[model samples]
Target: MSISFRVSNSSKFQVSEFILMGFPGIHRWQHWLSLPFALLYLLAIGANILILITICQDSTLQKPMYHFLGILSVVDMGLATTIMPRILAIFWFDAKVITLPECFAQIYAIHCFLGMESGIFLCMAFDRYVAICHPLRYPSVVTSALILKAILLMVLRNGLFVIPVPVLAAQRNYCSKNEIEHCLCSNLGVTSLACDDRRPNSICQLVLAWLGMGSDLSLIILSYTLILCSVFRLNSAEAATKALSTCSSHLILILFFYTVVVVVSVTHLAETQTTLIPVLLNVLHNIIPPALNPMVYALRTKELRAGFRKVLRLGLKNK
Candidate 1:
């Protein structure tokens, strides 16, 4: 199969070992462009980490809902660390070369974190559902034991299901093509390098993608439906509006995430589309939402806004 190139290299265009077209091949302007991304990555990590700390230390945040929020922060940090450090390395140094094993490792992280994030969203949805639907029982329903079980289940579900895809992709024999046309080592770019039939791996990705994302989406939808039905029963329009406003934020975030998720899913199934398109889509999926996460919650939640004020005051006094 032939491919296109943006680089000026001639002989090595098709048969290159693996030219990772990360940073969109902007060799010169990349250094400058990457500065903003680097700052954003740092900001995302720091914001999430701080939020996690505040959630843990603050007595008001001791509830299971906040437990999920803290967990979400940790996972956000994990996911960002998994990819962005390598991304930074790529920008600072010229070490875009990822060995076969390293490539597999990256894919494993991408899969695992993707699954975990989905699980966290599922947990958050369930949390919202309980709080809205059965406000009286929200505390008891999301008990410590049950939360433990839910986390365990999410871990097992994600780990067991997505592991095989990378393993399968790793086992495939790459004839000569090794160029990953993206910033990070992804399942598709790796699978595309294989010389032999990759239909199985492709199918595995589709299935897992459907199961992981689709399942999360279905659960979220179900929860929201229940929530919508229950919320309308409340007598206070102000209360209903407040609750709807919160749901609206999550809905917007889910919509943003699904835009990339569905687009990439369709791109994979299309088989004729440019891999670059998906690579960019995947990058947006992995980065933009995360960068906005803290901002979203902060702008919406009164406590976080207050916490930010307190923290800023403390920092100023310290200075």
Candidate 2:
């Protein structure tokens, strides 16, 4: 069967580009909102970069957990870069016009990075599980080679699975309205603009999301469940406290990441009543998680905090 339906004579002009109608109902004065967003982008980028550099330079952080943390930092930066620049352009400069290729590229990057992040979270959960449940074997099990393999699998899985999303979106005939009422070129936001059959595109997206995120979330929960059970079995309260502390940072980051994703996923159901909420949350979801991930780690993880302090002290001594 043909991918796109034939355009009827009554159809409007074909859409070669889309206008991202960022944050509907917000007044022009709200363009000032760009200030906070830009600041957030800077903070997220700076924090993640610092984390990456520290992980690379600090030989003591050569373990699987810190390796995975470095991967997460990179993924966070990619996610932020994918969505933030375009959003800032819309908010600060009113450059909302996105060509078809550019929109598809953005959609692809968003989906790919999101999947990668979810996978990395799962890897981190496993790292925590091993550290708590089998500390002795962790050195043998979660080696640098294993971490490299996991990262490669994540990249391949998401990169291969998410390709169809933009391909299917590109196939649709967008002969109607070209205005996207969102900050970023998301799969649903862009697919909804197509004047032709969108059922395949929607189904493809839903399946991919569930398959990628659903499996990752399920495994992460199982890992944590086992970790908790193992923690409870410990006779010493101090031991238990130390064990749980290792996971606290990861749990917080996971909660924030998945909560925003779940809320954003279901926002379409109440889109009419909560017009700006969905769009606003969608933009914030991409930016906030990346910004908060490093902060949570720095504040909660002792080793990371110490590493950052060490880096700072060395720089000061150099000066």
Candidate 3:
């Protein structure tokens, strides 16, 4: 994939690379915004790595919840790394040009990781549901083997479903403008620049979002609904409080994830009025959750905090 400003052929139909306009109407000095974004990326990567190391070294956290949390940390790292570095380059160095192949790869990574994260959240909700609703069967039902199988399924399901998005997108003939209005190579952003019929790409992306994220969210809501029912049935307030407390962190993360997604989707319809809003939210959707997920878990979940302390103590003793 070569980055060339010149047309490859006499035909204007032949395009080589795309120019990413980091923020459409933002001022030049606003490039300083990269500082905070860089900090978020660093914190996200560092926290996720620490979470994974703590989970691996501590046998006490070898349960379904922590196993899923470990997978989430990995997904968070992938999600953040996929867009942050390139975006920072665009912001800091004005390196906005991306070859076609690289753009398509970013599109694929973003969709795949987003789908995987949604599936993981669903799995985590089921874990909470079982532990709260079916305490007697929780140990038997949510086994290590079962968590492994669920992880494999989440990976396979999301991977397979998201392949068509980038595949269909890449096949399209981008004959006209090659400048994308957003930082990352999003499906809609890239497809909008195509000179050919982008209906197929749009339809496929919409279908995948509904089938993958929509279904996962539905199941999550159902699981939490049942969990709420179970919690309310307990006779004592302390029991109810404990049960709800276990789920609060997960719920907060879920709210953060889907709220941005929904706002971005909704803003697209009215994009003409507020062009920068959707772009800003899309970038935030990728960075904010990853930066916050581990912190939320460590602060709210008792087991995770204990594991974090154990890892910190081990490090101190080693020194």
Candidate 4:
């Protein structure tokens, strides 16, 4: 079940092992480079987890917006867990081999989380839309039951969309280069090795691009446009300024998140002799967004600023 289907019977595509090209040119300062990545990975997880805890424990943050923010933290953790461990392993250990099952699992986790994150972000945009554009009805519009249902649907959609990808991909023959050019089992990385015509896989990817990311980005854009229009129509300058500040956090988040997604999603055609550029971009695409999100939200949101202060005070008290 876990075997790579190679064309030739003599040499099965090495299922139990995969070759990883770790951070190129890191042999000289591998140890030094690892420290920063280690720190960043730790910070990324810590900050995101902290945000999750604050959102959950604080009664004031139990609203639909923070509820979704907490969910984003969970998704960020999922994304970070899927990538950072493999990335850290490459730096820590000399061995960069992954078993066939493990490799496919990584692919699944990566795609599923990314897809799910998109849906969640779209939900968040709509959440902001209701909160801002229709403030009077925001509570009724984004009820706890409705938020849960939206979250479940998003999770279910991403899960269903990406679930078959790795499975179908793993079933194909991989007699070609077993050495993956990236740190992890990237979707295109695995599919590139398959001897079978990857039209179906390509189609699936296109469907996801249009349906998952495309749809989400569109809705987010529309929400923001409406939000901006509403803000401008306000008579008070202070009110308009305050609205933009809130919108800016989401806009910044969207910029970082979607740029990488768009980059990697389209870079499939850019593969040539060396996958160095594409693979590096792919890893960056995953890591940078999750890493940037907490910082952006914390810096941009006054409420989040207050929460950080409160969290710090509580921590000091506990200490």
Candidate 5:
């Protein structure tokens, strides 16, 4: 893919496509690895779809929280779909060639969805904070308009900031290697192959990551802290328990998602380019949360489970 940009006009070398090595050290085990990953991808897609359908069908769930949950399902599906198919192709069929444009698109979608997921988490945190802290004002404060605006902001924040990551990478002079050792088109992995200095790409990615996901996580922590304070001050033990229970699923999702994110971030920062640990962590980060999120919500939230059951019953009756 020859990008005829002003800066790279004099560059003699250009890579048309990239060869993904797909776990360089584990070539023998890739077939076995594909089985579990494929299963996880299917579960992620299926569960999120089921959640979306239930939320849309159940009138009682037409509240602000459920609306956010529905948006989350869509994001989860996008997140999983962004990289899993290519990964499966690499593992199953040894189909690892990705054109430059396709790789750039994958990079953009992955980071955008990740940033949006962070935003959704923050929005869900705010929802819980208001519901628990100001029950009286919840109806007024967390309105449909508010949800729409939050989603719009979420999309813009990630969509715009993430563009630079892929753009910076794509603008680089790939005069050397055109092979990536990772399963997906990770920014760092792709940029490392460029003949030019990757400092700009690195700096851009680091700054945007902290500015987007870092801020969202910090605010989520603040919201939860305030919610905890309010819960403890409650007069009745049962009420406190109920408030905590309501946040249990969201908390679990937060814990798992951020934990993997932190590990991956640390590995990237440590510049552990020689090991497969970071690659594996990135795969887990992309796959596990989407698969687990809906299950957590369905099992923890009585309303969602009931909604699912009702949807199932209605479907059966119609048959």
Candidate 6:
């Protein structure tokens, strides 16, 4: 990677771009390591696109739940796209240099999409909650207008909340080395390189993360708890089984999503000496969930499975 030197205001040289070391200790094997990451990234993009297409073309999927699923696919694609390409470049071609603007954009985008995903998960949980817990009110409670409002809220909320993170990072003085330790331009990774104290950035990020994804996760737990209570209260065993089955796929998706998130958060907070594990886990957290979401839904949800089959048959017949 070539470095273009620029002068900072303090007669010190500012770093115009940053070098992203793919993995700290495993740089020699990056070419070999890129294979699985590449596959997972492609799977994430392809699967989410497939889901989006199926959801858009199928009229029967116009319900609130499907609306949120479509939004989730979009968010998943955004999250995967935000960091995976640069990671692939760093791994495959030694294209590790990222400009200041590019770094900031990645930080903003990754955080925005993450916040949106958490919000989408919460919305889906609420959808299931209303569907099972308040069957009679489900139609009125969850509507197209409501879904639209929720989408708008998510976009505005996350977009506004994350704008500061990149802005704060951009304002700092970068008189030192410009090499970021991680594969992507994470907020902490980028900001930590600044010459100034990074505590404000860290504290702001910690607070916003809790206010955003943390709160979403907490509400999701509550929603599911209510759902379980409603399911158990059903007088008939078959009805309870049906209700639980409806949420099983969603529960699995949520479990893996939050598990990876929690693990990654803990690792970051712990500030362990071994950074590779957390970095790799973060990459998997972004890529694996998007790839797995469509499969989980298709295999577990009857309607989505039928929708996928119909869409596939239509495409093949057209071909």
Enumerate residue pairs that collide in model 2. none
lDDT (tens digit, per residue) of candidate 1 on 50-134: 7876775566667776687677777777777778777777777856776667778778887887788888888888888988888
Candidate 3 local lDDT, 1-319, one digit each (tens):
2435445444555578998987778846659889999999999999999999999999999888899999999999999999999999998888989988899999999999999999999999999999998999999999988998999999999888899999998877787678787899999898888778989998898888999999999999999999999899999999999999999999999988988888888887567533777988899999999999999998998888898899999999999
Q: How high is each candidate's TM-score?
A: 0.88, 0.94, 0.95, 0.90, 0.96, 0.96
Quote the lDDT for 307 in model 5: 98
Q: Write the per-residue lDDT of candidate 4 for residues 1-319, one digit (tens) a residue.
A: 1334333465655344677766544544554656766777787798898888777666667778788888888888888888888878887785677877898889888888988888888988898888788989987889989988998898888888887778777767776567675678876777777777866777777776688788889988998999989988999999888777767887888888888776765675765544456666777777777777888888887787788778789989999
Estimate, for each residue in 1-319, the C-alpha lDDT of model 6 and write its tens digit: 5556799777878888988887778888767878888888888889889888999999988788888888898888888888888888887778888889988998999889988988999999999999998999999989888998999999999999999899989888887678777899888888778888888898889899899989999999999999998888889999999999989999999999888888988898897443788888887888888889888998998999889989999999999
Clashes of each: 0, 0, 0, 0, 1, 0
Best by lDDT: 5
Segments of candidate 5 deviating more than 4 angstroms: 1-8
Could you tell me how far off, in angstroms, the CA of residue 139 lies in candidate 3 after the best superposition?
A: 1.3
lDDT of each: 0.75, 0.87, 0.90, 0.77, 0.91, 0.87
Global fold similarity of model 6 (TM-score): 0.96
lDDT of 3: 0.90
Alpha-carbon shift of residue 96 in model 6 (angstroms): 1.1
Which is the winner by lDDT between candidate 1 and candidate 2? 2
State the lDDT of candidate 5 residue by residue for 55-169, as single tens digits.
9899999998889999998999999999999999988888988889999999999999999999999999999999999999999999999999999999988889899999999
lDDT of 5: 0.91
* lDDT comparison, 3 vs 6, better candidate: 3
Which residue pairs does candidate 1 place in steric collision?
none
